[model samples]
Target chain A: MSSREIDRIDGSALPLRGDNIDTDRIIPARFLKAITFEGLGDHVFEDDRAAMADHPFSNPAYRQARIILTNANFVSGSSREHAPQALNRWGIHACVGESFSEIFRGNSLAIGLPCVTMSAADMGPLMDLVERAPDTSLTLSLSDRTVTVDGQRISIAVDAAVRDAFLAGTWDATGLLLDDFEVVRGVASRVPYIRGF
Target chain B: MGKTLLKKVWDLHTVRPLSTGQTQLFIGLHLIHEVTTPQAFDMLRARGIGVAFPERTFGTTDHIIPTLDQTRPFQDTLAEAMLSALERNCAEYNIPLWNLDSENQGIVHVIGPELGLTQPGMTIACGDSHTSTHGALGAVAFGIGTSQVRDVLASQSLAFEPLKVRRIAVNGTLGNGVFAKDVILEIIHRLGVQGGVGHAYEYGGTAVDAMSIEERLTMCNMSIAGGARVGYVNPDQTTFDYLRGRRFAPQGDAFDRAVSWWRSIASDADADYDDVVEIAAAEIEPRVTWGINPGQSVGVSERIPATGDAGTNGAVAEALDFMGLVGGAPIMGTRIDVAFVGSCTNSRLSDLREAARIAKGRRVASHVKALVVPGSRAVLAAAEREGLDQVFREAGFEWRGAGCSRCLAMNPDRLEGNQLCASSSNRNFKGRQGSPTGRTLLMSPAMVAAAALAGEVVDVRDAL
Candidate 1:
């Protein structure tokens, strides 16, 4: 997957609301054995998907849902890139939660999976709406910092600099770092221990 | 107000501020292991990038290394390939690797401090989450993902957002048999898993100051479990004494100069902090995780939390169903099928010695399968030198070589289906110990030894 500027996502919401939904629960360690993240979506919440037939991901209506609404600290725990990869591959374009883990949010942003957070009070009504109308298409507009559903808007906030990356289409740190190769080399050359390779 | 040690280190290493609200900080030491670096090196190769500062990077085989019969052409093909990929990548890039054959080889975290490569006031990064283990020596260290690892390898720097420093002070004295592992577990229990979000934990206070380096390392190693990116202790005379004679530490006059600088970087008496939390060390008991996550813990003497007491009723019921545990019951005496004592968390020399002391005259239960895997090759040798290995072996535990054995189950050491293991590792996530249905209960090394002897989770205090 490559980084793309994500300004807006419009889709029916699939709500897996809870606190501290850690990466291990998102994609367990056993699924990370693959050489690459290929086919990880098949195992996303594998145990949960197996045990709870009623898990939202297994619901026929939410199968094509592109936005996941969840509670605080979503994607917390181990620094496994597979967590975001699984969400991305499973057709989640964005995650709207009360909070997200630092590393998990970083990984998601790198993969173009926008993880956005709102206040607990704001999240309660939003989750209520999503749960009430699972098929209602919600529009998350990064440019305006709001999520709109059926002409009604719920204003949201993302880190200003992170929003700038999305709006400017420069979220790829690797690409930018790669462009400044000479400067990196200059800094590396001056380090006391790094005289030569 | 004076700056905290974390701020001082960040100020020292800042290269530039990015438009993305992150600072590019020069990494003093870049450590890598077999599991996370292969794909990172592949990213570099794809980008036609060589390691810009190869000398700052060190490689080791840990995650996938076998603890028994580690011969050429490993029995597990994927494990051999991963190790080979690391060897080939390091060789091609001129990065020094402490291969399995090298005496310097061990768990990446253990080897760094023991070899004296990890020092005070440096920024250390590794692809593994437990890299915070190095912070016990007064450095600012954290784990990074594979992409960040690639960035560090190619640019010798990382773009990182600043973290608020939360000073967590544990005062008073700990009870007997309550180790550093219990202290951290108690902290996580009180703070909850997500309480440390967007903050770096600076451990302090009388209890923290009195801990040995090994005990401190154990505390910092699990800071991630509390959702903190970094955990550290201030450098002091104890830190200097620990590094004085190590192979990579500065020698003679250079050592004195280094010590002078290190002393300057310790948190000032009136340093500023974003938040302060105080805990009474006396309140902590030997902690045992009763649920899937590290934060889901109870004291050995306490009852499992009622399902209603858990924040979400669904999560509580789900965890109980998954772990085959009943709510409101005592945490001790939970039967276990396996016992493992090894990980970057609790696999140092002192940890092994403590476990061996508990196992000396006892025998493992007939129904239990127990193993002792040291953190590094050096730790393995040190344990054998003191006959700790013999003590464990005579008590029916298999003494294996050094590696991250049974930690994440990336190696041959793993649990079978539905088997519950009392492990000294950091994580207790479902399926973390190999089998999809396997269960893991996180505890201290001596607790694991006692569990092995009893064929169930038992109080180490009783054995003591």
Candidate 2:
């Protein structure tokens, strides 16, 4: 098996409930000027944490949580990979949400941070459970396609190809695409536009 | 059943199918910028890899480049370091770069089309999310993150699962003062911010066809905000007309041949789509975002939705609370402290012309600090040639340099604490305009011009 294979994750959950929690709120554009993503964890949700005293990221109860639970369309807007990098550096191994924006999901998957989804109806109870028991151990099993918390098994959805990438340990796509470099050149040669049609 | 442009382009670029059920697709063009490319290049260096097709890649400094004064070293050291890193990376990779001194330099999305690097029947990728803006030319463009950026840099390809196509047809003609910006805003309002997820939006119909190439770019630029990774308008005479004589466009007989290929790639008349959404152009009014997200908007004449009216999710309530606005309050007459017209969305020449038309002979309110930024140096030169700059200056609006000035506020140009702004840029996300408490009411350029004159949200039709 490849060393990068990520079949499961076990952790406490941090609940940040909201719709359309965009990347701007997660990291903000001001913090994006750095050449590298180092030290980004300290600034994740910097604005939100400063604005609201009760912001979940600033709460002490979820300080050690390795997973984030949020509402629909989580991590939308701006294809900044810094958002996922910040979360990854901030000790988040996974994110469970009602839905995730396409680019955000791709970015998360690229970094090996599984962003799984559950229906809104199913997510409400899970979020409530996490809020009630912040330290409750949550086990997300990609092999079983479920999240087990407090003896309750909740079915989750992962895009088939994304799940396959994780299970096969090919989530870092650069190597995979580079392996097919000749085929890529062949495809480019066949396209009329690429050839100055 | 017929094929869509997206399908045709996807098939044309597919290298092979992988075991993960993902297609390894070739990217025709790769656009890079400062903020997102530094780490991507670092990743390549760490892996001992080189840019596989450096000629296909283009770099420009935009995100961190200051608008007011773009000297060798920016006032902000981080911004300067980022730009310097981009220069070094592009040079090392043998990729052509349009730095601050380059006349062709501007927002990557704007310069791509302006330089004719963006074309129909191609697949484009960029590190910035607004890379979808190139799709206005009938290309299938995607905004990718840094790792994917590295993937493209090293392999000139990326793995992707196919997306379903949703044809959003807007019929009839747009009324006076309604623009492409308003139409897109209306589409986002009707289709919630997340509604277009997993779909590539094919924008067509009489209304969309009526739009100019720049307007189409404006419409496509915000596809990401609407949760769509890609959006496109099929290539037509309008597209051809705009491409003709552009710097990078094919010339002479090659141009004619290219057009035929572009025409062939458009969705067939009987094209099958996974879903279709219909919109009436006349029904779409001048829209303005009243809350945190772009979808949380209403027409200028409408009132903010109350808690009960918005829905049970409490998103609207939170927006209202954060925005410090009362539910059921009319969006019109909302006071504004700043006005800006710039961004990849509506910073082209046509956008400036529209804003200039509204600003002519009208003085900006004493309390309102208004600025108009061109999308590119070319757009600025064109505006200056037509005396548009004079019109804006005489009207008391600051005519600034070409860059993403107040849009994301990565540079010096930004809103102050809690300043409410009438903006023509895309995305009204909280803290998007730099200040944590800053508020952005996204509208058309003309609407922003009118708001600057009135010092509050106002109907551009009335101002006209």
Question: Which structure among the candidates has the greatest TM-score?
Answer: 2
Question: What does each candidate score in C-alpha RMSD?
Answer: 2.4, 1.1
**Candidate 2 per-residue lDDT over residues B200-278, each given as its tens digit:** 9999999999999999999999988899999999999999999999999999999999999999999999999999999
Q: Model 2: which docking level applies? A: high
Summing lDDT over every window of 10 consecutive residues in candidate 1 chain A, give the lowest-scoring window. A188-197
Instruction: Please report how far candidate 2 places residue B202 from its true position, in Å.
Output: 0.3
Compared with the true structure, what per-residue lDDT tens digits does model 1 show for residues A1-197? 22677799999889897777877777866566545667988888887677688999888888889999889888777777778889889999999898888888877776677888878887888778777878889999999999898898888879887887777776767765555666666655553323321
Best by DockQ: 2
Error of 2 at B106 (Å): 0.2
All candidates: DockQ: 0.40, 0.91
